[model samples]
Target: MLTTRVVVRGLAGLLAAMAVLVPSAPPASADQVRGSQSRVLRTLGVDAAWRVTRGAGVVVAVLDSGVDPRHHDLAGSVVTGPDLTRGANPRGVRPGRLHGTYMASLIAGHGHGPGRADGVIGVAPAARILSVRVILEDDEPGFRHFNSEARFENVVARGIRYAVDKGADVINMSISKDRPTRQERAAIRYAISKGVVLVAAAGNDGAGKADGPYSYPASLPGVISVAAADRALHKASFSNRNSLVLVAAPGVDVFGAGPGDQYWVGRGTSQATALVSGVAALIKAKYPRMTPALVAQALTSSARRRTARGYDPGMGFGVVNAARALAEAARLAGYRHTASGAGVQDPDLPIAAGGADGRPQLAPVQVVARDTGLVTMYGAVALGAAGCSAGCLVVLIVLVRRARRRREHVMIENPQADRRRRAPT
Candidate 1:
């Protein structure tokens, strides 16, 4: 879901009491995490974001194939959830749970070692993950059957409800499909209505196509659709380009924890979406009562490399900045969460007030283009000046004709005088 929102209930007691804000660790610990962190996490400044909060008290639901809870990097972080496949694996194809494990590691990997440093350190390292199996790998046994037939098409919808009921603060669906079913839409609507922040992959269909097909769940009204950005910060060739893209993340040559306690390198919007879901968990952990709309506003309003229009189909607002988004959440927290979910989500409109938590603004919306009014006003004035000038020219031409006629009449009456006047002068 993309645009749907609801009035968040119960702003009670969950501020400082809910999240045990982990103070900034000593330099040695921070340095160890930084030194061991991969280029991808470092690129997003996930280390800097840890200074504020490590996503202490939030639960992110990973709706994917299935996660390997025994992985070294994700030992205590995973809560194994239901197997929603409804059917067994195909004859020869086995379920590796490779894709799901990789995505989970990105969202909540707790690196293994003395300083928790020898492996991948996820964006929200302290966030817990609920592994809800909804989709299978492309090479898995029942992959084609599950995707092509209607027998188990509603698994995702059921997964959403299951995650919500399991007390998931954020739901991360790194899968995409071509069509939308009524049950899926209703499930998403139900999740959003319950203040669950939804995120999904925009799809991997970019290469030859300008704008790819609308990926379902990503294109839905309330889901935050993630695109894949290359190293140079451009949309990846395989990443889908569409209006549904909310923000992009480093999705090229991404390495993460895989099943069997191994590390794997993968690329796709699935990784990008997982990274963004981790950031959402970070925000949720800090501001326990922040509404879903505010969570999205924090991400989009503070996105990096944004265009002048604030949005583009290639990357939507821009790439996700973990530290910047958390700072934005601090600003949006003070806004009175209204029933209609008004005013605050708009980046263009000035917020009546901001949070007093004293976080610095990384990027602010500087330019305001009143294009419609200015164009109409200037266009009307130019048209009026042109009309007035044309009328004056016409009047002058008529006067010259009248003067020429008078001269001709005088010349006819006195041909000799006219010829003398026209001779040499």
Candidate 2:
């Protein structure tokens, strides 16, 4: 017999730390007086990216704990959407509840101060945040107990649909779950079909472990799974790693607005996910016609890979590079490519295919016939077999078999022949 357990994706370490710091700090300064701008802003090259676009017209839907619209940093940037969390009003943030508010500020916070010491500035400072409350933090009747997986799924699914219907270009789901229901999966597909760029947190449960269970929405096809990295550009100890982790961002000591116009520094994959969503908003704002697939491609293709060779379970393509992704998005805007629905895995071959650590995976390949006249023996074999005499076809078959046997003999004698063949001339 098998049993299934539902786990909420929210990480508690950073939030708990923030709670402790909030009360002891000075009234004027909520927490320690650190730099107003997060180090991640510079790490991700947000300054250069901002010069390109401040995510002017893009609306990023934040599906998490309710966002406080009155927060100074996010005052004009937040557009309050439906509150799926029971007893949580859409107008205000519950006392001490700051998850959604923090996420919003990370995506579009317009700091109150003049320099890095005074206020918080988001990667896309001009982007608008659509606050769609999906996670319930209160001790309501139906959500009193710790485990409310079924209810969580229902509300999150509704939130996704709501964001899409409301014209959200990017849906930022910082919440995570161990498993996904059929309804939730369909909702994700629906969002992708509408060309909404979905981004989610790669769970933070791999502190001392090398591998951990995958988190959903993040693991789902088409959703960009973001892992957390510290200011030093190292993968955060708590950030879960897997093939689904598409990219990483600064999640350690990340500073953002809290409730009651306060600010706090926290570290979690949730913060990393929010940062990626902001970058996606920037890309979408610049290229309004870009599809979700191409947006993902822009991010992964332009990411700073961990190793020079290829992808790794710890960092996926690597940390998110905002400037490079923005540049790539601009370049992609000029190209004509089929718009694939969300969750479409990249079709490119493995960068280090056939290497010691890299195994070649079978992927679909597309072939196109161009106007330039190019012919091969295979084409001749097909045409001759279809319209010419059987004698010609027989001859072609014999020649093909001879070529195959010769190739097989060479491979049997020298298995590393491709390595040599691929060497630079």
Candidate 3:
């Protein structure tokens, strides 16, 4: 159970300040080529990554305000999963409720103009989005009618579980709370166990308080915590600086799709988190069997180290390098073979070798071939599942079976039900 007083006291001041600081949504526009203005894409080498993979056959779950699935830039990418907020209509677009839509576009938006270069082309343009509504608009009328912190907590927890159960490859949580609860921790652990990659924002309270409490989910174990970087690859002043921050991305003046077929600019760790999530989707598309821990390793290991030393409080490892990370993932996927002995050739193999003396000598050589069979198998499976969209059905069946077993266990533990019924007559 949650008390309204605690939530009001904890978030009222912060939410009020954000309403004034964060830019308001702009009017709908016809110009769709504005995505080139996004500095993050150019700085992070997204174009090079796209040459290798476009995040096809991957699903990223966005947990935030409801996304506008019908947005021009996000058409056919957004999949409405669930609306956990109380009294809020599912998938309904309301004014001041476009945060999730913006985040979704940043992760997987496919531009709608004359060509692919137009509009907001997300870092992972071919990825699909699983929109899970977990936030409610504070400006809505009768906002106090909803339940207290418990409601918010339950919604977030449920959203995480739902995303994992629905076969989300990467889970992007752009929203943040000051602290983590038991339910939230359990939900995150559950997702990690299912091989889901979790990414979250490091909070935006960095003006005078660089030492604020670590943000929830982002600071949680097994979650990739992201900080905000500006166009120059420097940490944003408003991005909270904590040791929990794992990496940084371009979050300043980040452009994305908004509600009512409009586009807007946002600045915060939320945008940075979304960018990282998109990159994670790309990695998953290339290597579907990658574990959550290895995914984090791929991002951090290949990051462009900006600081002189090991780590920085503001920048974490450094700005994410998408091309470098993808290259690393590719290397990780190759097969490793060891030679039996140094400078030894196969006895039965015919080899033409020339030394200083005009005599046949063993030529020093080695050959390594990729396991194309395994690669083809995984590729075929990915293509088949994407063609039919049967990924969710498999997960749904597993979840249903688990639920049934749990209910059966409860009935077995409670024999009092039969005793009560027999005596009730």
Candidate 4:
């Protein structure tokens, strides 16, 4: 009886843990396995709705292999893009469609179109897709070999600048290698300077073999590094564990659109990265004024705290919590509104003096038009000054006239006395 009681308690604890670990399933579809839906829409209810309307009007630039322009799910979605593979013709044609197609499906593909039973919905369906291909493609000559003459830096640099010029709010890069050239770092920095929120994969090699010293852009300071997780929310077997990792998202058995008008499922750090990027697009669309820094703060701040606090080798902050992130975003936005309004009190009064961190903030330039009432003191003062000058001059003239009349009256009344005094004198 004692042994049986202990076993029953242990099983109950396991069930409770599973309940907490398991995320809500996505919408029902034919291709769904037991955990398929659980992997797609990790945040259900409010967060899911938040995603639908939030990603609208935001453009997300995807840096990967070439995306299939003709795919039904991706039709009418891709903006102008270029392929960076070394081989093929002068026009960089679509390389092997696997990487780019998969990344696009995870972001904005419309679920591979009809007939295909797998219902794979991207995290942000409304986001505009900007595809920039960077991977090498194979040809009859056994893959287009990148010669020493091929300028990889030039291609990638041009791609990043193009995305920035095109006004991509969020940039997603799924490729990572053991060694990241200096040019790559410069490209990442340029993107950041343009206010592009960049998200990169932490790499698929678990234990840090394939990704040397963390991944390329992920290891960079400003980049948001994302890792993969299973349905149980445990670190994915293939994901590299590193302290530089920023967050985790569903990556294992994640279903998405494939090349040749097909539905497919795969796992990688790339998939996790696409999900994170989609969430960023949603936030940017919802809070248009939010800076990349503030969006990143919202995501990191609202992360679901695991037993391991702060960032860790496996999970940087923890699994990405779309519901919590959106909630925190709402709160941040409210606070910003309150603070912005409070910042611009009566301009008649001097702004309160304080330190940098504790300083009383001034309102943004927009408040001048919204909250201020114009007082035209210049025109009023000019008119008042003119009237006062005229009145003073008139009073002087009237006083002078009255004095002259009084003098004349005195002369007339005392005429006889004055004549006698004058004759005696």
Candidate 5:
């Protein structure tokens, strides 16, 4: 479904334009887990519980620079993409080259092979990748730091649309703009309509003035915002907190595949967002029929809720729990099935939490007759169907029994002696 090539222009110069006053972030805390303990891997039971299940048949579109498709860990998982920063050239596309590539590796890179050569393994190692290069061509150094303006909002929107067209089940926007543009919001809405789950960083400016509503996509409605957590599972000093943030993941000291088969570590919401995106991929893979609403609920509900009641502005649902989320998804879906199959119909079937996107058709279940009478009617229909099938089966058994009785009688009457006399005559 991926249709058009997005053209990135002046905006490529924007990513590095941030003011120099932004202080250098402190080194990641020692308690922080290295890249290996990313929330995505922990939540999804990567090595301990989860085994590959067809790799989810889900594609995650990475709206960043071109991915090193040949990376040891990502060789087969990558899909060809456009260079939004500059037009495709013979030399190849390079936006914020290392940044984008590293992000991709965290989500789906195959990683180093035996003996430390494989590099860091990504959270969703089996998921497919779609890279969109949007960094400016003239701002290479700015790409390294916050010295230029990154036209990421527009490019991100367009890239999102392309990702939806390409059948991506999840979209990871690791890049963040100083503010959310109308275009960016609209693009996000469009992607939602297409059934794509979007994840974004809460921002690295948590300790600085970069706090407050200033966080763009992370604070935006419908986005699965993420904050950074250390190895001890505590929030990162630089990671922003608010009710809008959905969860936290291992961000500090997170390592990923870099250019030239190397690995690098960094501290930022970018890593957290990638890890969450990977978790989403795992959920989609486990339950192909699940809707985004159900997936989100499962993720939030399974999380170790923050100390505050309800959804605290700091952590939307809590830290994600891979095993618990999958278990919850299966449990909820099962309950829905039971309600649907009961003698009565469940009127709320149309509005169940798991069927929001409307991609898969819901099987009619028995509607319970309650204050919500409409549900009762559906339940009646379900009972009727079950009853009808049972009645037909009984009728079939009766007919078979009658035929057997008749055959037995004829065999008894025609004894062996009578058969022999008729044959001789």
Candidate 6:
């Protein structure tokens, strides 16, 4: 019950944040089946990144409305998990899965058809997806209820932990919120500690200018916040300009797969986030043990920096270049590579970044230090509770032995002790 209240209370102003990442309304138009990849591929240089790895052996968790594994491009790649919004709404409310499906296709969609040539090909075409539904579409039934429901208030926080536990190499959180929750921040820290790369949309509230409201998860430390970019390499008019923005990706007129054999062209920071997540997958697929900080380093270091010296609020370091990022990752991993981006094939690399069981591990010293006070506090509480339990057990055992001895003495030496027991009374 306390946990429930925390989750509920933690969502005090979070409802406003959800509207910034995913568009408040469904794609206004351009919803159709495109027979080829969107121009985003060319703009992102994903083909060159493919020479390094097609994101094989990496699992990206998509936390959003829900993904349709049955989509033509996403077939055989998506593994559905629990719906965070289940039963949270009142009776007779159903949600639509347009957003989540679109994001997943951008992350791991493998186009269907002869030679796998047709349909929308994702940035990381060979990666797998763990689809964990954490939100409901705005137009869907119960959308308001889901947002207002206490049980679902901590959906995004829970989804982050769930993805990390499921061995996700990278997490794509195309969703954003204005209100920051303690649970959500802790969850982001947990993922970072576990060496999981997290990417999020920088919000789409930038109306062709700067100084947009900060977006959580994206604004949260250790997360690679992605902003939307246009074909001309300019920040999208709708992309949020904030300190959290790490890198930009193609977000204008982005083509992606829908819930079925359908496709849609949408423009938002959400699409850009998915593309960045795909790039992270490629890095992890090549260097399975690279820490989240280094993975982020690889991205920021190799980006087409917007300025000469430092980062800009609009696009941060600049647009993300996949092939260059791969090269940077290879350099950080101390592995040999060819110009084609394929080189050292370390079969012995550990699958999980830290431990085999996917436990949270300590990050490198040079990595930016994050607040682990929550983890320490929880640990201290658990330790204190365990100590109390042990002390109680010791006292109980001593009392029990004393009682047994008294009973034995009453039977053997003081047979009249029982009769005299009530004397005082």
Candidate with maximal TM-score: 2
TM-scores of the candidates are 0.71, 0.72, 0.71, 0.65, 0.64, 0.71
What is the lDDT of every predicted structure here? 0.77, 0.75, 0.76, 0.65, 0.63, 0.77
Query: What does the lDDT come to for candidate 2?
Result: 0.75
- The C-alpha RMSD in Å for every predicted model, in order, reads 15.2, 15.9, 30.8, 18.6, 16.1, 22.3
Candidate 4, position 413, lDDT: 93
Model 2 Cα lDDT, one tens digit per residue, 267-318:
7888899999999999999998888989999998898747666687777788
Residue 174 in candidate 4, Cα distance off native in Å: 0.5
lDDT, model 4: 0.65
**Model 3: per-residue Cα lDDT over 1-425, one tens digit each:** 11011121123211112222123334333342353345678877898999999999999999877789888789888899777765543345453447788789889988875575556778899999999877765654424443254445467778999999999999998866776666677688778777899998887778787575587778899899999898788888878889989999988777777777766665788889999999999999999888888888889888985698868989889989889889988877653222347755443222444344455656666898889999999999999989677777888899999999997897789878856866955
Predict model 5's lDDT versus the native. 0.63
What is candidate 5's lDDT per residue for 1-425, written digit by digit as tens?
Answer: 11111123322111111111112223222223234445446544656425534245879988765677765657778886776544333244334355666778778765544442334566667788988765433335333322223543366667877788888999887765556655577677666655578887776656553343436666677788887776666777767766678887777666665555555566677777887787788777877656666677777888774656756545566777666766787776543221224544232223233555564434656777566576788889999999999999999999999999997887798877557866854
lDDT of 1: 0.77
Quote model 5's TM-score: 0.64
In model 3, the runs with Cα more than 4 Å from the true position are 1-38, 88-96, 145-149, 334-425
lDDT of 6 by residue, 226-279 (tens): 988877888878788888788998887677776656666667888889999999
**Can you write out model 4's per-residue Cα lDDT over 37-129, one digit (the tens) per residue?**
444675422246464364789899987666776666677788857665444345444345655776787787555435533445566777889
Question: Can you give the lDDT of residue 73 in candidate 4?
Answer: 66
Worst 10 residues of 1 by lDDT: 8-17
Off by over 4 Å in 5: 1-44, 52-54, 87-93, 112-117, 136-153, 208-211, 308-310, 334-425
Number of backbone collisions per candidate: 8, 2, 1, 1, 41, 2
In candidate 5, residue 137 scores what lDDT? 31
Sort by lDDT, best first: what order? 6, 1, 3, 2, 4, 5
